[model samples]
Target: MGALLVVILALVVGGCVCVVWADRGGPRWTRVVAAATVGSGRVLRRYQKSQRREVGGGADGDGD
Candidate 1:
């Protein structure tokens, strides 16, 4: 009975963890605001890469 209880507890905890994790994809405007903000370096890099592909030069090539 105790072993069963332990298993149930573990399963409950695991489910809670999964729920929390599944809820953590960030806000709807996260990507849009990230491309604007320096908080998301990876998104910024991808945006810059796309911009470079669209244009002829790297993002840094333009004068700041």
Candidate 2:
């Protein structure tokens, strides 16, 4: 019975530690992060579009 009580106490303490850690923002920092993520995604899209060739444009020097 003593060993069982020790095990239960350990489990309860471990759970409390986990709760505190999570309340401290376990790993996600999205809330405090800047809006640069959205801005950069737009910039990347524009860059990709600029690299693409137009439908009427051809690689050859002649239009015949």
Candidate 3:
């Protein structure tokens, strides 16, 4: 399980690198990776927001 977690972390980091490269016009293939990166990021953000709501957390801008 530890090894698998490490591998997944590595892949996520690599994908983020590809996303940055593609944003800077690295190559055509990088564009595909970048798209996947953006899509996954959006999904992750939404999931996190939903989880926060379930835990009764307000939007991140409600500091007093």
The prediction achieving the highest TM-score against the true structure is: 3
What ranges in model 1 sit over 4 Å off? 26-64
Task: Determine which window of 10 residues in candidate 2 has minimal summed lDDT.
Answer: 29-38
From the highest TM-score down, the ranking of the candidates is 3, 2, 1
Pairs of colliding residues, candidate 1: none
Better of 1 and 3 by TM-score: 3
Model 3: per-residue Cα lDDT over 1-64, one tens digit each: 9999999999899999999999899999999988998999999988988887778766657452
Model 2 lDDT per residue over 1-64, tens place: 9999999788556555555555677645432232334455578776765554354354535433
Off by over 4 Å in 3: 57-64
Stretches of candidate 2 exceeding 4 Å from the true structure? 27-64
Q: Per-residue error at 60 for model 3, in Å? A: 5.9
- What's the TM for model 3? 0.80
- Comparing 1 and 2 on lDDT, the stronger one: 1
lDDT of 2: 0.55
Q: TM-scores of the models, in the given order?
A: 0.38, 0.40, 0.80
**Pick by lDDT: which candidate is best?**
3
